[model samples]
Target: MTGPHALKPFLLAFPGPLRDRLVAAVLSGEKTATTGLLLEYEAEKEELPEVGERSALIDSDGREVAVVEITEVQVLPLRDADLRLALAEGEGYRSVAEWRAGHENFWHGEEMREALGDPGFVVDGDTMLVVEWFRVVEVLREA
Candidate 1:
């Protein structure tokens, strides 16, 4: 809370079934890491998250459900994502390839594409990615 931005919103994804599922995972401590596109940060004109920084995990209803502290932050090509990160996501992926495929499907979905403001946007291995690891600091909602 000492940073320029005291607290920011940590949104997982577009609201709906997927967001609900991801929120549930975080609330239950099943998820500790998440992947994001570098373009997203650029698009929003937001600074990249840093280790030790905290943000409010917002739910679909715009509620600050929890406070999560960033423990790690890595920026790399999507192709460089490894098994450790794949497992850290807590999405039950058995391999890195599976993880990439699953995420590709998500990134290619209508909602994500729409949010990116490029209906034809497509992610490739060379795409820049921001992978972050966070820990739940406090639960604001009972879940």
Candidate 2:
């Protein structure tokens, strides 16, 4: 078993304003969880992060800000996400409706489509996602 101190550093990229906000929330301890589209992982040919995996939280400028350790990993449909899980994502989302609206907008936005090169992409009830719960293990004040 690997501990945070023994794990190799993986990269968690926060590319834009919303991701930046979520990164800040994680650093501040307000956010302890996040979700990623399973399709994105599949498209990128990336393996799902397992529990106990530690990663460097990277900002838009490609700097490491903190190290986080995954505590849990859950695979579920997007529509199965509940309010409790949404609240754990932080950003002051008071209700599931708010969380779904924000995430749906992000997932279906032009920016994502352009980046992924799939203009017809859609997130429906059956959309699969990797739900991860993590904790900030160390904040890199200088990197």
Candidate 3:
């Protein structure tokens, strides 16, 4: 217990308010799913999460607040992103339009742009997404 935890870090977003909200959602069971651009995994050379895989949910302050187990993972296009998935994110999007609108804002944010090394990067219908669903297994800490 003196060193870093063994599980890989499962981060929802950047380290700030956005991530804080996301962590809260996960911890409270309001959020059970998340979507990420396939481009991000490609850029980082990361593999897709498999069913039953476990990870440490790292919060904005670098604390492992919980352990999450992946239940499902789907790779689909932006056009295929559905309301069910959106609703599971627990951000209170009532429609697909609302979800896409919110996601577009984040996908086009400066931090994401910088991470992708493209200031003008934009998401489109053809854009691929890695939609993952997970359940919190254990909560290690609180906010």
Note the residue pairs that clash in candidate 3.
none
Pairs of residues clashing in candidate 1: none
Quote the positional error of residue 107 for candidate 3 in Å: 0.5
User: Candidate 3: misplaced stretches above 4 Å?
Assistant: 1-5
- Each candidate structure's TM-score, on Cα atoms with residue i matched to residue i, is 0.93, 0.87, 0.96
Preferred candidate (TM-score higher): 2 or 3: 3
lDDT for each of the candidates? 0.91, 0.80, 0.93
Candidate 3 per-residue lDDT over residues 1-143, each given as its tens digit = 12665888899989999999999999999999999999999999999999999999998889889999999999999999888998999898899999999999999999999999999999999999999999999999985
Better of 2 and 3 by lDDT: 3
lDDT of 2 by residue, 28-125 (tens): 88888888789888888889999998887776666678889999999999889999888998878898889888788888988777766899999988
Give the local distance difference test score of model 1: 0.91
Better candidate by lDDT, 1 or 2 = 1
lDDT of 3 at 92: 86
